[model samples]
Target: MSATDDVDRSSWLSGYSDTVEALPIELQRNFTLIRQLDDSAQELMDDVASKSLCLMNQKTVLSPKERQQRLANIGSLLNEVLKRGEEKFALAKSTYDTVDRHCTKLDMDLQKYEDEQLIGPTMGRPSTGTSTAGSDKRPEKEEHKRKKRKQTRGRKKGIAPEVDEGQQQGEYLSAEDAKQHAQSAISLSNLPIDPNEPLYCYCQQVSFGEMVACDNDECEIEWFHLECVGLRTPPKGKWYCKNCAELLKIKQKK
Candidate 1:
């Protein structure tokens, strides 16, 4: 047993077979560097789980700094919905150019009312009447010879032709003497001392019966039945009319 302990036990078994012959290569190279660091840590955990499931199926969920503040609030709501749709298409093209300039000024006012009703010389008259200007017709005898030379120069200037209601019925008065001469000229304008019987004159009874006169402009004033001025009932305190209470007492004595 002692040859030096059999040469130290064959040199320790030849240095343990040379350390088991370098372990496999070192264990493949450390297991290929730990399988390339586990495929880079599973590709950085699949890029952080696909950006956290794209911020949890988004609609608006965000967090990576709130998805950059929800992408800057969706780019300011698409620039305020494209500036309110370009201001409603420029106000619908300025209301279609103001309704095409009011339909070209109503087609030039309907062609000037059809050229003033076809230059009318009694245009198309037939209202069931006699009129050929009263008819002996040579253009109604030249329009009664130019209306008898303008009514003989308006009766040589005294101008009496406007006599309508059977010639102004003797100038005026006669609606029961113009309501008794407008109640004798509103009781001779002594203003309202009339305890119920004043004011006198206001006529116009059929054909030309007029007479009107009151504030003494030479006496003819008369016409009373506007229910005799209590104006058909309301009276209690503020009564008025007697020529507006004598012009409001001459405007409160001036």
Candidate 2:
């Protein structure tokens, strides 16, 4: 087997070896000697059994002196094996007691570490203190501000703020300029004007009808007949042509 295979095989016994090493020097030596004695005793027993088997297979009857000598050798080997077995048992018991003690100590240390580092701080609740003067007044100030906002919200809609007049006049002037430009462009075209049709009326392309002008002053197209745009009656409020409505939406977005 490779060195890696040897290491892997020994890993299961690593804990046992570590426990033994932690023992006192005298106990360590005693355990080692016990293991050596056990191995030696096993070898001697195996040798004696093998020799007896060979003798029986050969059908060779032993002389009386040889028989006695063989008996003596077997008896000595048996006594040695028994002695070594007892010593090994004693050493094993001692080693087990030492390992169990070490394991117990380790468990207690782990529990102590967990209490001091993980549980102690979390279990002790922090003390509460009085709020500062500034903090104590903050809520009252916020309540007053909220009351002022509610009072403003209760005002009548008729008292709303007025729009700037200069902005309105500028819009009116721009609308008039756009209308003049559209008229000039139409005049430059060579197409003959139909006197029967209203200018800027989409309904003229489809059918003749009484047309209404868009309320938006900036719109170049002036009139629309409701029938052509799928409306049964004139719309409520200020009405706008499709082109002027699109332009108004763009301005509002800006």
Candidate 3:
């Protein structure tokens, strides 16, 4: 090859220009989805922790309904966490399978190229590519199987790494299991909140400090935080959140 071609190839070998095509578009898209799902799941976990802390507050008095509401929120969060975990696992598994297929293809292609380049009178070069491809197929298949088993053999011999992680974290698949865990955790702290019931706010947070209640009785989530509404204090007269105001306007026109 020319000197320019040699220089370009040498640069690639030195890893100076390798990143541009390092990942395929499909893999990049999958990675983005994975990260988004992970961030959302982490936020849900934080919300669960924050709500749990609220339930543990000894000074704050919550009515039966309010307490039930908080518990119910935690339960919903636990269910969502499980759902996200399962989704991430499935997506990762699909990505793994795709990579496996690509690797096997790469192996076969390499064998063909090697057979072509090493051209000589080795049992006739016309059928050499076919012979090499055939010979490499069994080894490629066996290597794929070996790698799969090696990666997954740790957790009960066939479970994926993701499954092993979930098992290690106490197997909390639903709110019921979480509620039980909370019960055990609360016994020492003497927290009165059950891990089940439900609440009313756009933020899904415990009603605290200063909050404004919508005048409309029909409002699904009747409460709003002053900070959330961009107000320092409650409105002087009847205050309605944006949704409640729209509903009231509709009612007035009707």
Candidate 4:
């Protein structure tokens, strides 16, 4: 795996190892206390058992005087056992309390570290450079609206059309002839024109309807005056009206 993967895995592994290792050291101290208490209790129990056995033997088979003496000895040993057991039980309870307190402290420390590392960076604060104050602040809403407007304008206009790098070698014509030819044969598609637009006559230099229609006599479109056509230059070489340009793109696709 890559270095990043190794580092991520190691971070988690190390944290878990630290937590587990801490428990053993803590448990060791508590267990030692528990063992000491148990040893004391066992010693007391052994003393009581040994003394009681001696007393029984004396009463059953030895003289009556020896039995009385052995009875006192057994009673003393029994009292010591009971006393030792109580002391040991108290010590074991104290050890448990100490271990419990330590564990609680460790848990709290771990929780604090977790909160600081995981939650702090995301929620604490935004970076200074990422935000601005007062009227200079750019509102997110306006920024989105600006982007949308730019995209809409882009959709309306194509990028600068490609111009022919080399000059055309086709038959040359006088400016007037070029305009006349352009006017006569250019029949437009049935697309409607706005009536208020001026229509120019190719021969008479007269404008009629609000459009420049071509002179295919069968055509429904108006023609531009020859002078008007010559006066209007192509943007570089490629020339098309808004609707014609859109149509050209569709034809190119086929």
RMSD of each: 49.8, 44.2, 26.2, 41.1
- Model 4 misplacement above 4 A: 1-37, 59-69, 124-254
How does candidate 4 score on lDDT?
0.51
Q: On a 0 to 100 scale, what is the lDDT of residue 194 in model 1?
A: 21
Candidate 1, overall lDDT?
0.45
Model 1 RMSD in Å is: 49.8
Model 4: residue 219 alpha-carbon error in angstroms: 84
- Which tens-of-lDDT digit does each residue in 1-254 have in candidate 2? 35875686488358646754756775677778787978988897897798677656756788989878877877787788788788887777666566556666556655665445443443445533422343455467667765564344323211122233321111122455546644544553433333333344552442233334455655665555444444444443355667887898899999
TM-scores of the models, in the order given: 0.21, 0.32, 0.38, 0.32
| lDDT to native, each model | 0.45, 0.55, 0.61, 0.51
- Most accurate candidate by TM-score: 3
Lowest lDDT block of 10, candidate 3: 163-172
Off by over 4 Å in 1: 1-68, 71-75, 80-86, 91-95, 102-104, 118-254
Candidate 1, 128-239: lDDT as tens digits:
3454443334465566765574455434433333432321212323467546645754554432222323333232221112211122222233233332332322222222
lDDT digits (tens) for residues 52-76 of candidate 4: 7666565457777877777777777
Total backbone collisions, model 1: 15
Indicate the worst ten consecutive residues by lDDT in candidate 4: 208-217
Point out the higher-scoring one by lDDT: 3 or 4. Answer: 3
